[model samples]
Target: MNEYQKFREQIDEFMQHHPQSPLDEAHRLYFRGLFYYEPSPAYLVMATVTRFSAREPLVEMETSTGDRRRYRRWGRAHFTIDGEAAALTIYANPYEEDFFLPFRDATSGKETYGAGRYLDSHRPGLRQLGEGEIGIDFNWCYNPYCAYNEGYSCPLPPRENWLAIPIRAGEKVFHSSSR
Candidate 1:
């Protein structure tokens, strides 16, 4: 099978069988697969990264479970959907070189998770396109593990990352979160 298919299968397996899966036995019993919006080319974008100043302050982000987490404003990824300009902040772990992105679009409560979604930096969809550009495939976005289990502490998308436009790409809410 193709690499992407293999990767998806692996992720599905992990969700269903891995010890770290957010699902407890009761939830895992009925697990089928994640729901997703039909893949759209409109949301596969190459956004230019605008680095934040070294002195940019670290923001305290609220979490799904009422916890607070701090992340440095590493940079912003700017792109466009249709004719609407969009931008989202990229966060740094302060202790790690890795980057993170959490966002909420117009489709958030109605179509996706209410808590927002995440774009894994190491994923192919968020790959480095060039020196200061990164590919952001909305189809590859996924819900935080907190969506499934309240025990998980997931950072919510800050106001800066909330987009007015509806991004009808990526994973939608799982069976129980349709509300």
Candidate 2:
């Protein structure tokens, strides 16, 4: 199996049996596994980051539980899909040195999580920075913990990060008959 599929397997194992899983005991029994789009090379990208200056201000992110969380505007990622231009602002957690990328594509509320998906330090694929480019593999994008269980409050993608195009990759909406 490929690395992406292996990653999915690890996630499945965690969600199914880990005590700290977002899924409660009752829900775990009904969860076969998370659904994912077949890995697609098209979504893999090396985006050039435009670092923010001191002039850039911090932004507040709205969460699923209606709470506001603040993050510093770190930089902007500029890349393309099939030669079509696209850009997303990258945020940095005020208390931590990790990057945060919350986004909603055309697939949201349909093929994927209604609130949005996330790509950040919590996952492995996009953590390292190389020069001015950051490797972003949409295949690593995942639904926030809230998607599996409402008990978890996850940050929603900002309006600027909402993509007009569909990104048919990574994790799809979870399905559980028990819900």
Candidate 3:
């Protein structure tokens, strides 16, 4: 199996057997496993980041639990997939040591989480792309805790991060039929 396949298997194993899994006991009993699109090389990229001006305003995003989290528009990463140009704004939360990327694509509400998925990478400290770029592997994207259980609050992706093209990669919708 490929590395991503192995990673997916490990995630399934954890969600199915780990006591600390977001899935409740009842759901775990009937859990089959999360779904995913066939791994696509197009969805993996090394993007060039354009840093935003320091004067950019900090934006507050609402969460599922009616809470707000603050994030600054740190920069934007530009890339293309399948001949379609796409870009996503990277946000920096002052409280965290990582850059946050919450995004939604055409696959949302159909093949993936409706509220979107998240990607995170360690902050390069200089507020610039590490090594002049950052790896953007959509295959590593994942649903938030709220996707498994509603008790957890997850920040919704901002409007700017919505992509017009389907990103046929990463975690798929979790069906809670057994529950």
The prediction achieving the highest lDDT against the true structure is: 2
The whole-model lDDT of each prediction reads 0.84, 0.86, 0.83
The TM-score values for the models, in the order shown, are 0.91, 0.93, 0.88
| Candidate 3 residue 78 C-alpha distance from true site, Å | 1.1
Candidate 2 global lDDT? 0.86
Report backbone clashes per prediction.
0, 0, 0
* Top candidate by TM-score: 2
The RMSD of every model to the true structure, in order and in angstroms, is 2.3, 1.9, 3.4
Candidate 3 total steric clashes: 0
Model 1 is weakest, by summed lDDT over 10 consecutive residues, at 170-179
Question: Which 10 residues in a row give candidate 2 its minimum summed lDDT?
Answer: 122-131
Residue 132 CA error for candidate 3 (Å)?
4.2
Residue 17 lDDT, candidate 2, scale 0-100: 94
Model 1 C-alpha lDDT versus the unseen true structure: 0.84
lDDT tens digits, residue span 72-109, model 3: 88788888888988899988886554688999999999
**Per-residue lDDT of candidate 2, residues 99-118 (tens digit):** 98899989999999999998
lDDT of 1 by residue, 101-177 (tens): 89999989899998798886776667766778888888788889998898999999999999999888878887752
List where candidate 2 sits over 4 angstroms from the true fold: none
